[model samples]
Target: MSSSPATRRMSASQRIIVDITDWNRFLFAGKPISGVHRITLGLLRAWKKLGLPFEIIRHDPETNRHKIISHRFIEEDFSEPIHIGGGRIEYSYNKYVQRRTRYFTELAKAKLRRFVKKKEVVHEDFIEGNYEPQADDLLYFCGAGWDAPETMHAAHKWKAQHPGFRFVVLVHDFIPLINKVYRNRLGTRQFRRWFRDAARSADEFICISDNTQADFMLHWRRCGGQGVPRCRVVTNPHEFLSVSDTRNQPMSNGELSAETFLANRNRRYLLTVGTLSSHKNLERLLSAWNTLNFFRDPEADLVIVGDNDPRDVRSLSPIRRNVFLFQKPPDDILKLLYMNAFCSIFPSLYEGWGLPVGESLWFGKVCLCSKSSSIPEVGQDMCPYFDPYSTEEILLALTNALFEKDYIPSYEKRIDRGRMKSWATYGSEIHTALLKMT
Candidate 1:
């Protein structure tokens, strides 16, 4: 599913119209970007770098209109590097400033366009012109659309208005449906509605992993979806590994760098990145860690990152002093922790596509993750796997990863960085798939 530069571009008349409605919402929410958001941003950058003819649009819920976002505006405002490092106050201040800047920038552009009445658009969020999809145009939604029901409604409307144009939805995972008990009740309901609507509206499906594709097909069929749309699997890439380069940045006042923090502790650490959600299997991981008696080991420490909810910390408070949890660490700090870790553990019971597994492999670290779902597809032979549900298996893997002298180095030697999937290849595969359907 690879494509050369020449084959990646569509014809002059046809274009890939990416729906960034959710992307805008993510930015506006001022919350830490999730894996889905990162994927959306990465794909946009990849497509832009490939010189593909594309336009970005956001659905306006108030008016039920799709606003064409200026490519220049996106490039200038968002395409900058993302590094949300610092303490709580600094992070909040930065996010607030960013939001206000973007808000004013878009508002000013809109006002300036009205005053000048120029034909050439500079930077407008809501463009004056209406966009009618051409027969060959591909309308793609590559972001998390379940959060925005308006996007799904727009997709349905677009499919009805322009029957000839192709509409596609990128399926990240069916976790919300599969692991409903582990998710928010209202969110899961919305996910079902979104998936059903997408299945009915889309002419093609782009799944992030093989397992996700199978789940999507199974659910689609069970839901009594209409005529089958061509489905394809275009796996997520490991470009995030490159974000570990934070050597040149100045250290924040009174804050120790991740490297210094680790050095000060003077201990080896096993790292895990994810929320405290039950599906992540953190409770199981903690059980194994405690059973192993590493909680009392001064030479070893278990550092948990990405659990922002304070209520979830109550369960973990029982752990001994050696266990550490850094809630919502910055990307740079997280990458640094990965770089200096003894190993990484992902005890997720299920996953759509395991980002932590891919990330660990990218860093050439020993990753002990679950055997279930799409994780193995990312880890392959570079890491050891075990049943996430089995504490014994997890403990065994942990013991081997920690005690076995050559266990990690052996796997690390096999890490072929060059063979790893990249965002460019990901974009090319999606483009090729769309071309095939056309």
Candidate 2:
């Protein structure tokens, strides 16, 4: 069978005009800081390394339009000294009021965190501008569009203006729609709006997983929508332990950094990386850990490495002992944790792509993950699985693997067979496919 255009690669001589129009978070933070932010930076950096010609653009709040940004803008905001607090920013009269409002929201969040540290907080500091979509340019949303309605609405408007203009969106997941409990009422409603708008606006979608694409299609049908776009299942690329990644790479001495050593205290640990949110099903994992009789491995600790605190797990009866919660540790420390871990555990109930699973596979480590959502799609036959819902099943899987003398070697062999495409390859492939679309 012939490959679809979405999957087909462009010739070497072919070039696509890709306009990345969704830098909503960066525009707010003035830097790529969080995981969501890092995904955009990593992929863009990879594309630049591949010498793919692309432009960065943002929606104009004033006029609600699209426009190409100046290269100087990139240098100023991304590369050089910024306008505010050593950060680059676009200043506008309207945006000034908006940013000031958000500044106070941050203070409010700080106050609220004292009592409810787990609350998901967002305070944006962004600028406004106007732009028009060029003919033959392929628009790419760099992140979730719901956070910036201007960007989402602008895409729809531009599509209406230029009916032949092609655009692609990255579907991280339909987590909110799939599990309503994952998000609050406001977040759920906003994401639903983005989904409906994005489904209508884009010519194609790059799904992070087959499960994600399926979920999107199912939601599309449920919304009484017709004619699904060309959705390609391209999982996120994994960058393995870089011997040269000094920024976040473990030390060559194979010893944890002094600070990390002091923090964790050289204990046998099972690492779980990602936001410590309710969606990750941390509560069940904690419950299982509590029931497992820590006396069997007194030195063993479950280290939750993430930004958001797992508030749901705090309420578990007879909470798991020796639970170490590390909030937003440095990348080098995270690498050290992963490298020294007895085993990595990811008990997320839902995921668009289980990145921690991919990370474990990348590192040739044994990962015991929930056999739910897109996790199995990533793990396949390699990583061990347990039903995240039943605490007993999780405990059963963990006990079998932990007590087994030869399980690590057996699973490491399985990881060797499970290969993933690198970011460099993903960047090159996406460039080719998108050029073809253009």
Total backbone collisions for each predicted model: 0, 7
Global lDDT for candidate 2? 0.62
Q: Summarize candidate 2's per-residue lDDT along 59-125 as a digit string, tens digits.
A: 4322233444544433222321233112343322222124458746754554554456454222122
lDDT of 1 by residue, 110-147 (tens): 55654675453222333534456676778888888766
The list of candidate 1 runs beyond 4 A from truth reads 1-9, 72-130, 179-183, 241-260, 294-298
TM-score of 2: 0.76
lDDT of each: 0.70, 0.62
Q: Lowest lDDT 10-mer window, candidate 2?
A: 77-86
